[model samples]
Target: MEFRNTLEFAQEMDTKDPLVNYRDEFVFPKVKGKEVIYFTGNSLGLQPKRAKAFVDDIMTDWAELGVEGHFYADKPWWDYHERLIPPLAKVVGAKPGEVTVMNTLSVNLHLLMVSFYTPKSNRFKIICEEKAFPSDQYMLQSQVRFHGFNPEEAIVEVKKRDGEHFWRTKDFLSKINEVGDELALVLIGGVNYYNGQVMDMETITKSAKSVGANVGWDLAHAVGNVELKLHDWNADFAAWCSYKYMNSGPGNASGVFIHEKHLDKKDVPRFEGWWGTKKEERFLMKPHFEPMPNADAWQISNPPVLSMAPYLASLELFEEVGMPALLKKQKSLTSYLEFILNEIDKEVDSSFEIITPKERGCQLSVFLHGQGRALFNYLMEHGVIVDWREPNVIRLAPAPFYCSFEDMYRFGQILREGILHNE
Candidate 1:
């Protein structure tokens, strides 16, 4: 499809878009009394308009039922988290029995490591990508330290080629083979937060297992943004936050995926609590810990219904539109954005080098060559909401659920004007 940098062309594409109406479902923040072009969905998603009502229902139920709300609420707070399973499962391409909602991303990763990151005297090294998200880096460091090992020796980082923006799959495969018997686990972010590159999880997971290593993914950027098959990929475990593309809220709850093969195993080591036990035996407070038959076995506490409410509300949108439709729009919308960027770069004296590779989802991490923070500040003041990384890179994720083609075109215009103003 030929792309144009005109408002009419953008509007025409929106008119043809099947998911265009979803833009209205979210409440965007205003800058100078106009809705800003939000491009930071990779950092935090806009609030779903329906989220307020979902929270209200929980608030009203608590007011009416008091202590009995756990059993008497319309959705029954005791089991509210279960309602999120089916839709959340569908979004991540896993069976309902293989997924559950729980603590935040880092917390869940720590818990999952208890089951999957077992290291022995000879096999103790973990393989991960170079420059992983800070939380993941800290978590892996602490985990290896707790097991009495130096992080420098226990963690094998797959480095990108010098001067390249993204990692090559062959390098990871070669690293796994080099580490060989010493590799105990392979945990890396599915979609790199810095470069927006989607790792080839299926191939990497296969290679990791062949070397007797457990594989896991931190899907913070990948979960709702790209296609995932945690179950089919045979990933031992994975975790993601809901506040990004999932559109829950700031620092909201997270989702977990545990393979069916790991569920209901009494011998599997885990940090257990009452909520993880079988529901029938939970009230009994029995002496033995009988785990849930599914992924909920890893849960350590009762569900936070208030936090889960907004997530459930967002999943309604997912169920209605489906990931397939979202992915289809995402490809076209992102392609149009790339075209707009190229067009703007040609017209301006400054260079805009998109660092995000072709394997990306909705995000485009562009290096603003010959430009500086003044341009980013101008963009923000002019009602363009985007994320600025250290140095001159800006991450723009035009989420398909709410972001429009018009936003991309308008952003290109604002960006061009900002560059010209700075000169």
Candidate 2:
């Protein structure tokens, strides 16, 4: 598809977009009396307009039903988390029984690691990407130490070669080989948070499996942003937060994936709770824990109804629009954004370089060389809301649900002006 760096072209694309009506479903942020061009959905998505009503209904149920809400409410708090499985499964490309809503992303990762990260004898090392999200780094380090292994000796990091912004697939595979028989687990982000590179999880998982190791993913950025096939990819487990791409409220309930093969393995150790007990016997108050048959076995407690209401509202939108349609618009929006950014750099004699791979979803991480916080500050003051990473990168994600082509053009225009002003 040909792209033009002009407002008219942007408007024309927006006019033809089938998903244009979706913009109306979300509430945009205002800056200085006008709606800003929000490009931070990769970090935190805009709230859906129906979010309030969704939460209000849950509130009303609690008010009228009180403790009885667990059984009699419209959504039945006892099984409210089940309502999310169908659509959420579609989002991550998993079997309905393979998916479940649970605790936060890191907590879910730790719980899954308990079952998948078991270290035996010589094979006790873990392989992960370098400079992972801080929480992941801390989690892996602690997990290794908990097993009585030095983090420096047990954690093998796959790093980018000099002058490279993203890890090459071959290098990642080579690291898996380097770790060899000592590799007990291979855990990586499905889509890297810093450079927005989408890893080929299927190939990596197969490679890791061939070498007799377990594989998993942190899909926090990939869940709703990119197309995934966790079950098909044969990933042993995966976890992701809902707030970023799914547009659930901040710190909302997260989704987890446990391959069907692992679900029925009762001996595959986990930290259990009452909610994980088989439903029929859950209230029996037995001394021993009898786990559920699917991903629900990982649940530590009943889901937070108020926090999950917004997710249900967003999932309804996902069901209506679907990932196929959403990803289609995302391709065009991201391509147009890339084209506009390239033209802006040429027009302004700027030094910004996009580090994100072409295979990425909505995000483009731009390395703003020579220009620093001043350029970022200028754009924010002028109503372009993008995220700034420390040092020199600005991350922009034009979410397909609400971001329009015109917003992309507006961002390019503002960026050009900001660059020149800072210069």
Q: What is residue 129's positional error in candidate 2, in angstroms? A: 0.6
| Candidate 1 Cα deviation (angstroms), residue 61 | 0.5
lDDT of 2: 0.93
Every model's TM-score: 0.99, 0.99
Angstrom error at residue 129, model 1: 0.5
Supply the global lDDT for candidate 1. Answer: 0.94
Question: Residue by residue across 80-151, what tens digits does model 2's lDDT show?
Answer: 989999999999999999999988999999999999999987999999998999999999999999999999
lDDT of candidate 1 over 1-423, digit per residue (tens): 888899999999999999999999999999999999999999899999999999999999999999799999999998899999999999898999999999999999999999999999899999999999999999999999999999999999999999999999999999999999999999999999998999999999999999999999999999899999989999999999999999999999999999998888899999999999998888898988999999999988999999999999999999999999999999999999999999999998577899999999999999999888998999999999999998999999999999999989999999999999999
What stretches of model 2 exceed 4 Å from their correct place? none
Which residue segments of model 1 deviate by more than 4 Å? none
